[model samples]
Target: MSDSFPLQKLQNITTPFYYYDMELLERTLKTVSEEAQKHGFVVHYAIKSNANPRVLEMIRSFGLGVDCVSGFEVQRALDAGFKASGIVFAGVGKADWEIELGLDNDIACFNVESVPELEIINDLAAQRGKTANVAIRINPNVNAKTHHYITTGLKENKFGINQWDLEKVTDALNKMKNIKLEGIHFHIGSQITDLSSFQDLCVRVNEIHEWFVSQHLAPRVINVGGGLGIDYEDPDQNPIPDFEGYFKVFKEGLNLRGDQEVHFELGRSITGQAGSLITKVLYIKEGVKTKFAIVDGGMTELIRPALYQAYHKIENLSSAAPEEKYDVVGPICESSDSFGKAVSLPRTSRGDLVAVRSAGAYGEVMASQYNLRNIPASAYSDQL
Candidate 1:
């Protein structure tokens, strides 16, 4: 499946819409399954990344499980035809209603982040006459070597339970009757390109595993939550991430028990390259230092650039003119709405088609009606 967009077809559709390459998506899923199955690792698609119905349904059809961070996502996964037994819930601030929803659905496990959350899930499960399977989310303090905002496993970050509080967590687990201890979960951060960080995590988990055995506890699962990164600079050159190498890291690093199953909650690596934000050039404004290619899509359409200063390769599909430097920006009022500063693209003009590559994961899912702008529509390769 080619990542290139059809400018003629895109011209007929509305501007600032998502264009998904379903063929690419399918191939990516197949690769992920092949690699994960090689090591007998189970993968759960993180719904927080992209909950588009079509995307979710395709993932479900691949026989992958769902990893939800909220009650609504759990319902979304269910509505998309993912089985309740294959769904796993993980969040730091799960509301009471969310816990009830999970209990009613009998989700595979809830990755408990704190003692209070563990207690609440237990209470909710008891009220429902069900036992909630839970995995304690541990803060291993391992650096993911990525952006600070997305780094989650550090002790200072408000994500997993700190190492110092393991004793309290175990004690709370012993007292929480309605909850069944299932495993240990860790998600250090997002968009992690460094493999060494995962190796560090494996070492930490081995140490933590010994601690659990010392306490006479053996878990049935070991969930090393996913943070695999994708190449944003050259999506076509490296459309699919190095799944073989990625799974190999865990195969070699992690210490697994005979009865335990290893699981991963992958998001971006699976979907990032399969979607692009197709926007039309609204105007061309001459600036002091650089020309501005003003696009209809803004922070509202794709917020990753404005939110995390994330990079997405920008292309001008309508022109084959000599390469020219431009500051690709959106119509939003905020200064941070710029997609790429000093982006080199073909000399562009009004109504030129521009494609923002590598937006499948957090693009449409995180879009908003900010500025009262109508939410952008989506187009798929199959449909177009």
Candidate 2:
């Protein structure tokens, strides 16, 4: 659905702020909940995507769990009203205190990425006279075919345990009495548009699951970590991701045992289209080939475009003139600090309000204070 911004009201507020369509976010969460519930699957909102308190609160209200990659994230989830029992800690380098935090809180599970981490969790759990529930995060070597920066499931990635090392992990698990092997986890990558990548992951997961079963260590939960991408190109046409089809892939692909649970750690697909970076054109500089629509906001506010060369549709909310090609550059010192180059937009001018669409997931969360610029403020549609 195309978002209808209140340009009059938005103009009254400061420019270069994040404008969240809460209605859209709620609808996305509702769809995810309904679709995941259809197959009795558990969903954990990957908090790293957007840890905004309001967003987290809304997600928690939908009865989804939280997937945390750090101790701070775990605490943030707890502070946001998500129950400790619904938090799952995941990371490659969890410190001792982070592990201790999970033990003290009795979080749902720790998606262990390495045998050393597993051992440390066990040791810490033993010290507290507790058993830490853990899910072995396996590197399935499945190519997500997305940006290499976000592809995490391949053997070269530092995210999960490689298949060849599973034997060592199993042996370690056998001796770690304080650790409970509750499940197996896999995260292929981020911004994955191809459903076939997930299918490949499912096939790999089946093989790994059978191997685990052969070793008499069948996991109770199969956590297929979330990599479902959203339509960054055209948020209007596909605002809500196809959760129905996404869940169906897992339902038909996975070979689940009786009473086994399937879990997902979705982040972007649910929130990507719900927010936009609202900025104001500061100056129009004539370039050799294309005009430069330099906006007040830059990579400090949204870095996806600069970091991964990601595409986000730019619209001139204040312009209704005929379309023209303009390089929408941000007011940053770096040459790469741009939203889009050669972007087609309505005839833009100074003071025109512009919107960078499909940025809800990684926009506000990854904001930085580079160039001493204040992190952009946020405004919700309902509040506006």
Candidate 3:
């Protein structure tokens, strides 16, 4: 393995582990905070993307809230120094005990996903004798323009309450009197890089907010959920996400009320660019078309390529020779356990260190123990 890859001296460490560039994470956090503050928006670190402890600490220091999806995530955020008052919990199916946990911790709010869910929360809160601050996760039925698996705000998606249920839903909330309607949350999709898609989201949010006002149930918080993507292709060139452009779209387009508080749920953009999967080339076998650069770390280490058919530009760290094409793959037995086919790289060979770039989000956290392989370990720059 290498130490502080591409810059620091290489150390003889284990082959498979996650390596993070702390400097990149800090830079991203600062940019997200600075740009979001300009428009009175508060960003919550969506821990679901990558809950690496080292990454969470840096994100917590940025004075950002935590966007958690489970009771354990809520506790993880609190344990990581994210203020309880700044934590927001969201999920399609929140157990009653999870609701109780949120109430006990006094979490900021909950992204209520359905009519039945709203009723369940109200019932749970009434039992505990507390008001649960909530944000109705509305499915705006907008195309997120991303992968089908990650697209969340569509009509067919199993997320948020639909348009036809709003009137009846709001009426139910009014009758319950245990759940507080503090905000309306909208998360269209993830890995969305197009700025125009967000502009469309803003337009839809405004329309939904107006519809709520017509019902005389206007919310105080407007959480346009986070989906700002990173430049995964050229990881070194555009390491940080487009924070300035992302925020500007909302600032210039969305109409906000005087007392309304804006919120964002960012996960990948903050931590994705800062991490990479380090592996060692086990063998290089010639094929009919492209050569196979077999690495020790397989889809078990990073599943984005296998799951989303995603691309992560790989680097032959020890190679400085002229480039050649090869199919970078893992030692896993599965047919889908491949990094990239026909991937162009410098002449690679056994014992060469291969650094899979731009794997910070949806990478290590999604790793598995399939084939009874040992789970990967993590190494940080400061620690090394």
Give the winner by lDDT: 2
lDDT of 1 by residue, 185-217 (tens): 999999998899999999999899889988988
Locate the minimum summed-lDDT window of 10 residues in model 1: 1-10
lDDT of each: 0.92, 0.93, 0.88
Q: lDDT of model 1 at residue 79?
A: 89
- Give the alpha carbon lDDT tens digit for every residue of 228-330 in model 2: 9999878888999999999999999999999999999999998999899999999999978879999999999999999999999998888889989999999
Q: How close is every model to the real structure, measured as TM-score?
A: 0.98, 0.99, 0.97
lDDT value, candidate 3, whole model: 0.88
For candidate 3, give the lDDT of residue 268. 93
Candidate 3: 10-residue stretch with minimal lDDT: 1-10
What CA RMSD would you report for each candidate?
Answer: 1.2, 1.0, 1.7
TM-score-based ranking:
2, 1, 3
- lDDT at position 59, candidate 3: 85
